[model samples]
Target: MTLTERLNQDMKTAMKEKDKLTLSVLRMVRSALKNKEIELKRPLDEEEALGVVSKELKQRKDSLHEFEQAGREDLAQKTRDEIAVLKQYLPEQLTEEELRQIVRETVAETGASSKADMGKVMKAIMPKVKGRADGKRVNRMVQEELQ
Candidate 1:
């Protein structure tokens, strides 16, 4: 199923199951998807929709870190729950070794021999990894591989 259909299906299930957390997250994501469609004035293809989901997940992770840093356990837990719900929509994440291997290949492909060429490596690699890997983790891997 397309991401939108999957979201709608799960949202209904959440309502029936009385899963407030999952329901709330799905509603938020659905709204975001709608806004994106309106903004673009066209329906999103699967890749674009996945980008929206990944953006939402990234935002939740950032909020989660802030909540933890501020000692707001309640908010942190809620964000963690939201993250779990969002993760259901993302592609499976890359393993550390797999990510490292990909980073090495990207660096080689781009001929990024030093930190100065980091941008080249990242530019070439980000699209390859997309939702499968976190940007921070990719950056670290690229940095490690370049050294």
Candidate 2:
């Protein structure tokens, strides 16, 4: 199923189960997807839809750190819950070793030998790792491999 369809299906299931947290998160995500569709003036393909989901996941993860630092366990927990719901729409994440391996191979494939070649490496790697690995993590791994 398309991501939107999956979200719609799960949203209905959440409503039936009376799962407030999941239902709320799904509603917010659907709104985000709808907004993106409006902004682009066309329906988003699967990759674009996944990109939106990844952005939503990243926002929660970034805020999660702030919540912990501010001693807001309540907010942190809520963000964590939201992340859990968001992740259901994404593909399974790559393990650290798997990501490292991909980075190494991508760097080699792109003939990237120095830090200056980071852009080439990243451009080549992003599509291969899309939705499966965080971009920041991939960049860091590429940096490590190059150095």
**Candidate 1 — what's its lDDT?**
0.94
Candidate 2 — worst ten consecutive residues by lDDT sum?
A: 103-112
Cα RMSD to the true fold for all candidates: 0.9, 0.9
Off by over 4 Å in 2: none
Please provide, for model 2 over 1-147, each residue's C-alpha lDDT reduced to its tens digit, 9 standing for 90 to 100.
899999999999999999999999999999999999999999999999999999999999999999999999999999999999999999999999999989988988899899999999999999999999999999889999999
TM-score of each: 0.97, 0.96
Clash statistics: count for each candidate: 0, 0
Q: lDDT of all the models against the reference?
A: 0.94, 0.95
Task: Evaluate model 1: give its TM-score.
Answer: 0.97
Error of 1 at 125 (Å): 0.5
Global fold similarity of model 2 (TM-score): 0.96
- Name every residue pair that clashes in candidate 2: none
Q: What would the per-residue lDDT of candidate 1 be over residues 64-146, giving only the tens digit for each residue?
A: 99999999999999999999989999999999999999998888888889999999999999999999999999999898888
